[model samples]
Target: MRNKLILSVASLAAAVSLTACGASTTGSTSSAASSAASGEVAVVKVGANPVPHAKVLEYIDENLAKDAGIDLEITEFDDYQTPNIALSEGSIDANYYMHEPFFNDQVKTKGYKFEHGAGVHIEPYAAFSESYKTAEEIPEGATIAITNDPGNQPRALKMLETAGLLQNIEDDSAALTLTDEQNPKKLKFEENQPEILVQVAKDPKVDLAIINGNYILQAGMSTKDAVIVESTEDNPYANFLAWRTGEQTDATKKLDELLHSDEVKKFIEETWPNGDVIPAA
Candidate 1:
């Protein structure tokens, strides 16, 4: 909400919902891949989430991008759908939000024309609780809130399975839905939008909430605060800069450099600690 271009996650969900029912933006969109004359610079319009994605880009925009002949015009979106829509419609040059699995799912399901640049960082999913000190302390019939979207549900479930709540997970497929057989603890599963999971910290009924890494930071908590944290080893969820396939300009390429720079790595480590945000290995 600090940025003028930022939209709240709730409003983003509602706006994307309306667009799904035949209200998408029209016309061919273009990436910011521009070329500048002498003593000038190329500007690349980027779409991102407000919490960390846009924040990261803002750092590059101020600290590193200008020296590389690239200027970033960051537009923040609270929800995941708008950046892709804007990218396909040429509203922005690129986006810096989703990891590979979710990004691939979106491309596969929505048939969007997009390609990623390079890996940036991983926002590992975690299981958090206010009442329970550890996973073993969770009571039977405890209610848990998880992401309902196919792109993230499986990840949340996988985290729970790791926390010893459920099992019999066939694969890491996002489409897998649980049943009584998978519910060993008999813990009630409540599926809701990802953004709402952050509210579980203030709610007593939500014994264990599977929250995304981004929202966890917004709530002023770290992965170390969670009852169980996701393993970072070979994590497939490293978020990166993305744009239309074959449309990456020189400026966008420079973005990849700035994103992977040592400075950015230090920024991430200093900005977040205790594995709250892990730079892609």
Candidate 2:
């Protein structure tokens, strides 16, 4: 009877030991699964103009970020100044708007540490009209409407100068104000807000207007009608992703990846066929 008791107690001890081992293995597995799930997700605030810039990010936020494990949210801005301000104040993670030249001006003047990443798209500054079929049809001494704002006025003048419609204009890194001293077309310049120039371009009275790429696309004008278009191959005004200077290492790298992704490139090609909007690859 004593020997039987001893064997029974031994079997019970072995069963308890097996149960404890099983519990430990499960606990370890559960811990590992939890650790794997703990990967961090950051909310990146971004700012962009409505048409292509904002529209493009909306695509990235929905598609690209899911794979990268990033949460990109955008705050749209109509004016150029506000987006940068939002970025500076930590309201947004990054901004995709102005070209390098304009971005540099904002950083230098505002004394911020903002920096730009990969060239996403180039909304080429182009001239368009509904009144006249083409530049050849527009008469000499025509009343031309141009954007009056400092940042855009220079761009408008540069496009006109590039077309050879206007002459002897020097491209300056400093402030550029168009003078009538060498006005070859005998063009009368009517200055208005950049947004209004689009309406003016379509007006019967307005002969020709230099419009931004966004506005040009918005107005339903074609590159065929674009007397001149900014070429992405050698274009100087390629738009890029902007962020605080120090943050360019990891977070910004993810954004660059998104910009250069096949999805983005494909989207631009299919969305703006006939090269209305060109990718800055």
Candidate 3:
């Protein structure tokens, strides 16, 4: 495992430095003009996953944030845990990678007061395989891979349950962390972290694996390759711009506008049609 300590510091420093530069560049001129015309400057720190989330924010930086008189500095995380830690410690002002249930879990474990800022896009989970061309083609008895992290495990398991390969444990609301669950396919399950789940998908021993949208994009797989992908409309976990509790109203508002601006919405639509990444909106 990588050292969380070093990454945290680097993330903190990167966020602070960029926003500071943005503020110094236009702080006075914007203040003197009308709120929009004056080019007022606000500095904000945000954490995100590497592919689409960070990439989406960078798109905002280019089109929306710069014009709105806000300077956003972003820090990227590969795993899910560290960004919330950075936000709780005051290292970053906000984070944009997770949904509500996951964020709630973070607060419970890490002991921080955090709140959802703005609803961003949804990243549907996808099921992929190397041995089989499609989900239905996989033989009855095959090995499947899932994320090892507690947070992702349940989600993957739930997808399998929905696919009818596994019978979920009765009454488990958080069905992702299934143990002793009946596997009808007699499928062998291997647990790996979310980021590495794709590698497992590539293995010949692996028949199918559940992976998130961003990882699918990272692996250069298209929707055609996915045997299953999360439905955008009913997915419970809509990614949000999360901030330290009480701070959700101010810079967060601007961040929200920037994220959901007309241009960002259009980009998501055109770039990922079929409602693959539906805006919370």
- Model 2 over residues 52-145: C-alpha lDDT tens digits? 8877888888888767755655656554665666566554556788887777667778787888876877887877776766566667788788
Tens digits of lDDT, candidate 3, 145-253? 7766555566666676777777753433333344544666666777666777778877878888888777777676665668876666666777878877775534557
TM-score of 2: 0.77
Candidate 3 residues lying further than 4 Å off, grouped into runs, are 1-39, 169-182, 274-276
**RMSD after CA superposition, every candidate:** 4.1, 20.0, 5.8
Q: Is candidate 1 or candidate 2 better by lDDT?
A: 1
- Each model's number of backbone clashes? 3, 1, 6
User: Where is the poorest 10-residue window by lDDT in model 2?
Assistant: 1-10
lDDT of each: 0.76, 0.65, 0.66
| Better model by TM-score: candidate 2 vs candidate 3 | 3
